[model samples]
Target: MKLSALLPFARLLCVTTLVAASAAQAQQVLNVYSARHYPSDEILYAGFTKKTGIQVQRVDSDDAGIVARLRAEGAASPADVILMVDAARLWRGESMGLFQPVKSAVLDAAIPATLRGAPDAQGASSWYGFSTRARVVVFDPAKVKREDVDTYEELGDPKNKGKLCLRSGSHPYNLSLFGAVLEHMGEAKTEAWLKGMVANLARDPKGGDTDQIRAVASGECAIAVTNSYYLARLMHSTKPEDLAVADRVQVVFPNQASWGTHVNIAGAAVAKHAPNRAGAIQFLEYLSSAEAQEVFSDANNEWPAAKGVKVNNSALQRMGGSNFKSETIPISAVGGNSLKVQQMLDRVGFK
Candidate 1:
């Protein structure tokens, strides 16, 4: 065919190619393998996309399942980020080499140094905690006076024997608390505390933090151990009975006179083979921003890891007004010592 006759077809081909290229560029997505099952997380993801035009796709699973899937996928994994509900899970993922060291000034400046893991040789961090929850005490004011249960060590007092309620010893929340105690009080003291605390249980260790709160409300136990956020959830519930439970219990920030409250975290790490590295980092930084922090803290009844962000939950407000000191021990230390803490719990028969 003559040049003039072929010109229109050639032009059509170039236009199609350009359109395909543009579509590919516009289709940027960040895949998140998340162990956090909170419905509120949708708002954070949507807000990130609205700001940056990068879509987020999430696969929700238990921490172990998420880790196993990532390992199975290896370098070809589609996960751009790993969002977890506990420091131990994040630490486990990093230790297993599932995360890449991420460097973000926003993350570094907004999050406390202890919340983010220590920097590697090149000054990048493998994981960052965006929200925190204190493992605290809840007591029936009718049965236990506030001043009488001021510290964690007080829970083991003989006067409180047969009046304490707890979740299973194997739960990560309790494990991390035990880990911190081990870090501060050493093996012998922690072992002794565990023995006494176990002996004090009103019933066999059972249920989640929420169950412990309910037990306190019913006066089945005069005192219980639970995450601060769980009490926040109870206080904020639309159901009247849940609110009643909140009213029945008085909040206590344990160990305030000594080490401060023990805290665990909800955190994220960039997948080692993220397909959209820039978008992943941008999303991670967005999660660290003050706006996202508030949303997360309010939704989960947790505290923001970002400096200067306020805790908006009423339960938290009633407890300490957002300015109480938390334990200053590095969170990584708690995560690292988790195994030993579990072993001690098992040995002490903290069922």
Candidate 2:
């Protein structure tokens, strides 16, 4: 078995198969508004179609755009489920009361208490996060010494100032990272880190992770903070662009000793007024099963939210002993503080 092919739908949890079957037979369709653009997701949809005969209507778009569109759709929003990356966005949706609360033994039992709900009763179950991603720094082993760096806090040190590059602080990934920082290190430490990190930037923060990777590879910068999956994509892609990026950078898992790494998720939630609550619950359940979790991880380097999903490939395990520890604070803290993070970024001239 090819390593990535180890996960399939059958071995994974389908949540509520009988519920899905009944819903499918009723001529109803599940309308999904997703910010995820993985080709593997299509396989998930295809499997769902084949097994239950439910039409999975998915409209893929930027997470923020879809949220805005859904909000604009107001009472007329036809979306059954909403999915996206970055925890702050999900927290925003919950803060705005955009998604509704849903309870299923399957979901509650399958998801850890931490990932399934918001911080409190005020924002409970607005949504649940599933597949996960981590924000870590990577570098070229041949050009840089990996032993010198460990935590995100170290990236801003004066000794390595000019050698580092990062994407814009305004991006969701940074915001979520900032949120995690604020939650763990307090606002003061986070502010200090941001100020120092911003000052240390090898160049003006202006592009996506891909851009940062390019900068590192082209000798424009020696270190770049990026998601793990970007390497997987670049290494596996037939595209010349990805190939070039892969040639320049080597993946380095950050904070291996201090706290493993900072992580966030790509997950889903049903609408508050969903007419097919049962079906939506079924869908949520499927997302938690070992099958979907494995497919997500092996397919795109995404981590699974469910407890028992096999997520560590050799490359991931070798970096750190898969004893990953996520920030205890929920993303609502980040969502609530996103504006604060922006203000701080502006004050520090992170532009």
Candidate 3:
């Protein structure tokens, strides 16, 4: 054979080697579309990379913005994983076919059925809840008795008139809570409850959960509704004002005597058109691990969704929610009820 003839084959081999190298490099990266804006969550991503050697490249936005972006990008999206912080938004994505059904024995074994999206015919889930935050009542003990506002229903009682504070009824957090209320109380009763709550407002529903908690502490209202994690953050804070807020209000896990507290989730899924399908599944499974679950608790004050995972978060312990009975209603059902809940909010003028 001539040297010139061998040169052509050598060039072909070089090009093939470069192509394989490029492919391998691409496989080492995972693109994430995330709705979680917490700075502490950076640790979660870094931990994943440390364990799996897959670098995470993330685009951060709120749940609605992430959903809209995914819809606009469609099949061309580079996202391997989607992390969202609300059950309603996760359901919306699943309903829109934004997430692919994932079948992982690790995920199935670790997460409770009630905390994850409903399984498909093949026993695959569209999304899995990694962490939970309870919708709890915060009241000024000086003004309101614990028994008077212990349950979600009692917050609407005429006895509590002109003493309740809340964020917008249409917010996803409230929508999920209201949806759970509807699941327990039915349409007519839920609407009546909303009207009662409206009649009892200390002021128009304004501000975030923490603000509502502060309002209670400042004596702007005798009672307010907030997520447990928000309370936990205040409980865990070092700042004097936050500590004062935590001390002034009493926390109640609503409906402990009934179906249990209304808990919502921060969940993740594999993007429907994920460019790195295996990497996406790996990331989802990592989120179900005990280490990751602990971060969700200690760093963000959320409860672990994984079964049997224990957290050392003092804030969670201080809040006395360690053993509270969380409602067993399927998260899918709560998401399903969001639209109706929003309508009821409007009809009752619960802005």
Candidate 4:
């Protein structure tokens, strides 16, 4: 019930796994069910092992799969911790009772409170978002003026009809964005924006963020909304097509006046019935540490959750350079209304 009450159990969990899963010389292992598959995570996990002596057994899959599996596993789930991209998935998982509230002053200080909703948000989604990511707008400089779009609502303006590029609304990323919109502007305003966004789509929503960027490059649309990291990855990519796509799209942070760019998180939390609990919390602490965060950010092309972390890649710098000002609303609100947002997406004719 109370967070203070959970701390003792959470701490005992940390030590219990080290005993069960490890020999004297062997490090305690944490089985992490992660929604992230970026090669950068592997590097960070390796670094965590080297630093904390805890072995990371990561299972990569989509958020839905991890949540569903955790639910199916129930008390027997081998998963000690979970890492996921969108905040909604974390909240969704929390709602399903897949995660337990973990208490750590270090983590509390390290992660922002707004990022980690209390269990009340889901009555079970006890997890919190740790990493920073923004859903932003990008355009072909030659095709669209920077000032032409600032707020997400403007993308749906009639004059810009059929001039915007975006991915499927069902995509968790777009769902999160719409979730944020719904939080701030209410269901009515958000639905209107979605309808406008659907009408302005250059074509049926199909493909990932890169595809939207590619569409912009190929004259499919003048403007596209995507994560900052996607554009950063494209810029640094060795692949010619991605490089060309990067060359064509110009990055812009939207909704700066009221709701800065919509920033979401990829986060981790200990399982409620974790077979290896302490190891899991240590693993979470390890991830938020400077060393792991740096490696994760650099290798994965993402912004670090902890502050004052330097960004090495020039491409990352060019794409807004790690500003975490964030949108005015909490990511949990996005998770809470994800279903309504998806329905709106469909109602607006976004395929």
Candidate 5:
């Protein structure tokens, strides 16, 4: 009597176990809190899902908002990965203890050491930079000679006064560039240089890099500071007006004769309390892979951060030659000095 009665119950329990296991397998997910606003990132997410059969859930927000949300949620946060632009913001999150140190041989080998977090003697990284954009000086050739704008310092020269445009000081792009200068030139010299730049402003800092490029195109400003990708985007835009703007200006890889051009990154980190740690690491490593880096970077007109990988965007390539040199100052130093640069900008009346 007991065998017949127990057999049905045992079968029901086995079926239930299998069903639960299948559901868990199907639900394998990686949640991302990303500050990167690029539209092409969707494609990268899709590619990862296609390759690994793991789903990706994403929320897009400003860098500050992402940081605040992660802090509020703490260990219960659903974020498996934190993706953001700018080295300072990544460093800010790392400093706040938002990320866990990761050791992936793929990440270590693919990403350049200079672009990632400072490694201890053990060489584990807290964050990895996958793509980079150069902060360069864009000038209208009709109004300014290339020889006169050979370096970033030249923009602040008294002769260039009333002819330069810049984005607001608070923007991370400008701050990172300034931070790099502070690292290279001491505080006093950096402060003085900031003051000189402020004095040369064609107009008070107002819009973003794209707006600064547009201003240069329209003759509102002769020279403007902007990321190379912005100009590349303009050149690649389908809109005739954007192409016109691209044509009106040309790029100058500032400090080429000395420190090389300043660049910043759009990077990623694994969450400190990630629920799916393995998946997050896999995704991060995928992001560093040559294929993913090319798609991720070329989509935004950025250069890949992987060593030996080349940026194929003709527009970006034309802006800076293959031999273009990047400043050797570690990006972490730029992030570390972000606040100091901000303070200097404030003191100098850099709007």
Candidate 6:
């Protein structure tokens, strides 16, 4: 061929190579919509990027906000991964068809079956719980005996009347707990339990889990329910006030003799319309790794969702949660009960 002909061919090859390179670079990016607002979670993302060389771009919001945003965006959404802090919210997303099922051996092998979404016919899961927090009873030892508030059922006992503190019943944390209780106790009994709790309210429900803990410490209430992590934060705090609050309250992992304590999760899923599905799945797998599990425990005060992963959080150990019994109920079932539980809460005026 003549030099002029060869020159055009060479230019065409160069342009094609450039375009392929650009496309490959674009494929290395992963977009995440996260409901976990904790600053400590930054380490989790950074670690994934370091390991895979896949850059992560994240949008942070509360669980409800993230779910709403995903729904609003629908098929046109740019979200590749969705990280939510509650089992109910994850279930809500899954029920709404917001997540595409993922088939990952790493996830299946690492996480417990109860901590992940139900498998589809093809044996793929729509979501996986990366970390867990037990919903525990916290009480003032002076006013409430350890045995008195040892189980969830005791919370609604008339003997403990005018001594309970709770957050809004409609909150996702409460919804998940109530849903789990509904699974164990059945609907009619669950409704009655909620009514009893309403009658026992030390004050109208109004506060976050941490606030509930402080209310116990300050004597505003004798007994309260809170996620383990919230209490762990106080237990691990450097401040004297926080330590005092931790010291003033005794935590009980309820139902240890029976079905076990209700545990909630912070879970993740691949968006249904993920533009980078492979990268999103990779991120989910990374979250189940031993290293990532440890970070979740140490930084966020949550327990590792992956089986056999060890955590070094002193707060967890101090609270005797290292070997506490947790309910084996499938989290999906608990989340599915959210609506029914909420309605029961409304009928009982549980706030």
**Model 5 lDDT, residue 104, Cα:** 86
TM-score of each: 0.92, 0.85, 0.97, 0.88, 0.93, 0.97
Q: lDDT tens digits, residues 92-160, model 6?
A: 899999999999999999999999999999989999999999999999989989999988999989999
Clash totals in order: 0, 1, 0, 5, 0, 0
The TM-score measured for candidate 6 stands at 0.97
Model 3 TM: 0.97
TM-score of structure candidate 1: 0.92
Between candidates 1 and 4, the one scoring higher on TM-score is: 1
- Kindly list the per-residue Cα lDDT of model 3 for residues 1-351, writing each as its tens digit: 999999999999999999999988989999999999898899999999999999999999988798888899999999999999889989999999999999999999999999889899999999999999989999999999999998999988999999999999999999999999999999999999999999999898888999999999999999999889999989888899999999999998888889999999999999999999999999999999998999999899999999999868998888884689989999999998989998888898888
Per-residue lDDT of model 5, residues 1-351, tens digit only = 789999999999999999999867745899999998888999899999998899999999999999999999988898999999999998899899999999988888898888999886788889999898888888999989998887888877898989999988878888899899888889998899889888988888897899999999999999999888888888889999999998888888888889999989999999999988899999998898888978956787888888888778888877863568889888988998988888887788888
lDDT of 2 at 346: 85
**Which model is ahead, 1 or 3, in terms of lDDT?**
3
- Model 4, 1-351: lDDT tens digits are 899999999999988877766654333777889888887777878877887787878788887788778878889888988888887787788777788888776677676666776645434336666567778888888877788787787887887787888887888888898888888889888888888887787887788997888888888789999988888888888999889888887877887777678888888888878877777788877777778777766777777777566777577787767653577566677788888888887787777
lDDT score for residue 77 of model 6: 95
**Residues 156-274, model 2: lDDT tens digits:** 77767878898888898888888777777787887888888876788888888877888888888888888766666666678897777786667656665665577777879897556
Ranking according to TM-score, highest score first: 3, 6, 5, 1, 4, 2
**Model 2, position 343: C-alpha lDDT score:** 84
Q: lDDT per prediction?
A: 0.87, 0.75, 0.93, 0.79, 0.88, 0.93
Which is the better candidate, 3 or 6, if ranked by lDDT?
6
Candidate 2 weakest lDDT stretch, 10 residues? 313-322
Across 1-351, the per-residue lDDT of candidate 1 in tens digits comes to 999999999999999999989867745788999988888999999999999888888899999899899989999998999999877777778889999999888888898888987689987999999999888888998888988788888787878899999999888888788888888999898889888898888999999999999999997999999888888888778999999998888888887779888989999988999888888899899999988998887777788989999777766787775777899888888888888888888898887
